[model samples]
Target: MQRNASKPWLGALSALAMLSATAAAAQDKITIGLLEDVSGDIALMGAPKLNGTLLAVEEINNSGGIMGRQIEIKHLDPQMDNARYQEFARRLIKRDKVDVLIGGITSASREAIRPIVNRSDVFYFYTNQYEGGVCDASMVSTGAVPEQQFSTLIPWMVEKFGKKVYIIAADYNFGQLSAVWTRDILGKLGGEVIGEEFIPLGVSQFGQTIQNIQKAKPDWIMTLNVGAAQDSFFEQAAAAKLDIPMGSSIKIMLGFEHKRFAPPALANMHAVANWFEEVDTPAATDFKKRWRAKFPDEKYINDMGYNAYVTVYMYKMLVEAAQSTAKEDLRKVIATGEACIEAPEGRICIDPKSQHTSHHMRLISVDDKHNVSVTKDFGLIEPYWLGEVGCDLTQHDPKEQYDPNNLPKK
Candidate 1:
């Protein structure tokens, strides 16, 4: 009896050793960190974006993952707070030591966390349709930039409608830089900027702004506004019976304001984006199907979601080509890698110099019943504005984001 009992103990010890070894191997798995806003003013955009990232990650993991090892994600909501963004970013870089970091809804939030990730030499992806001009080796932007958006949008709007453009934008880095770009583009179209107003982030009442627009009587309105508070602008514009045609570079698709607010409020509104929920393509159809399967209750998937999805796949491709998760190794692949990734919108190639993707943008209009229709498609446009001002990541390890000031005025 004693001999048999000792034999059982010996077998137990052997099994314990194997379990420990397996756990150690699992610890070496790649970890990706996501800092997003799920319950704040920007949550309208952030929640869908996070859902999109999760969907792509699940797809990649189900497809044998990277190097036969599983990929894990650590997600945290920053509530659209700048301080929380910095704090959470530090924890992800220093404590979690995540291989890649993704998410940043606003330009201010992005700027807050960018330095921390850059210092730690971790790969960071910011997928918001921002005010362009970011150049960093450790950073890759898959979002539509101002030049990419306005170049196609402004000319079309100017041709369809008269040239006096009224502008209303949120007051931040994105809004400020976008205002400059708007001025430049309008000037090129030989149009006049009749009036421009910058509203604070959470200012819901746009009574004064609406009154100003009425006074100015511009031919069309171009809005760079953001957040739920800014969404009220559409309702107010309708109540005031402001019949001016509208064009937007960022708001309509990212915020899904058309879905949130009813028709007539957003009727006859035109916006340009790389992707929309209604894009008729096999890839897009499949993406929507998968998204519905995972989140049956979710209503819409906008460009914000599309950006998140594309960025993750792009990172995966770069990692596979590099065959390593080390920042330096991945940077080399991204800085010089030439590969096309099929996104829901279309095939996109990352510019080795600027780290921005070339996108096929579509001009869309919202009807009185809140239906979106694609009017025109601008296929596969490069970030020529950034390229023109000497954006090159391989030349040196410069970590500064360029301003749109250097871009050509005319």
Candidate 2:
């Protein structure tokens, strides 16, 4: 084919258009402040989350940028320290003046930074699943709530195992609230909780706790532990040979505990989660493949990472639709919205009332080979806890977090 002289002129015009767009993007960029731990305590979970967040940012920028403005991300590692989290949050808000903020693997870290971000009127997103029932106008949670998780999990566990149960959790807001949810759900379901314990954060020795569990001898055990140190519970429980059917709503498959621990530790353990790498779906499988391709050294992409990825995309949609990063404007857009994004788990919807993502929770069983199997699929469940508690951000901003005890009984 012979090229015409006019074709050269057309190419020059296209290059000029590209240059002009680049110059425009350079002049106007959206800043996103990221707070996550790359070392210490929650690093195992935080590192993966950071990776997922960066991946989503990369995808967004590549796909014509966010509203024609390139996204600028300032990632800070708090090293799993609450004081550091507060400091970094202040820096991001006061110094960087980021338009949007996303981070905090632990509920403690989130609470530490939440007030600062909310007071500063910054759009904040927390991607990790926790105890639930956080009513705040300045935040959007992309993780599954207690109602979505335990509503399916408790019933299944009770039916599979017996009614009697033992509960163990980390001593913090997330664990405390989760314990309450467990007791409340069991009561409503006509089941009994035989025992319960709260282990301090980073407490490894579960000798007394194990003895208590064995003595109580409930039908099963449910854990809400957090951090790498808490992983010892699995090994210790297995060592004690207290092999009753065990389950966890908060952190079983998170951080790939099944893979990290030996077969005996997690084998035959049951869990209910928002997302699992073993999910057999086109979207999930493709996400795993892409994750592997990007981070060849990493072996697992758990719910935390998956949720972080979804949160970023969720923010992108809200920001583009709102066409502004101002916190109030973003909240206003979310108030009248039902945003949906096809996540690795499935399609998650952001509820207008709750400002939390509705997820498709799965009943997962781990085998001796560290393989995960989906026992039951609880199709897309909403964060009804907030709505039940009469949390309406549109009408008025409560500027507070709600717990189950404060709300009506289920």
Best candidate (score: lDDT)? 1
Instruction: Report backbone clashes per prediction.
Output: 0, 0
Q: Summarize candidate 2's per-residue lDDT along 1-410 as a digit string, tens digits.
A: 24746488877888999989976664598888999888997778778888888888888889877888778889999998899999999999998778889988888888898889777878899998888877787889988788888888888999999899999988988888888989999999899989988888989889999999989989988878877898798899888887888778765557788878887788767888888778878888888888888888776787888888888888888878788777777776777765777777777778878788888888898877777898888888888878877887676567677775776333
Whole-structure CA lDDT of model 2 = 0.83
lDDT of 1 at 125: 91
Pairs that collide in candidate 2 are: none
Q: Compared with the true structure, what per-residue lDDT tens digits does model 1 show for residues 1-410?
A: 78768699787888999989977775667788999899988777888889988998899899988777688999989999999999999998888778899998999999999888878878899887888887777788888987779989989999999899999999998888888888988897799899999999899998899999999998889988888988899999999898889999876788778888877899888988998888888988988999889978776787888899888888888888889888788777766657468787778888887888889888999888988899998888887676678767777556666665664232
Least well predicted 10-residue stretch by lDDT in candidate 1: 401-410
* Residue 222 lDDT, candidate 2, scale 0-100: 86
Q: Which stretches of candidate 2 lie over 4 Å from their true place?
A: 1-27, 408-410
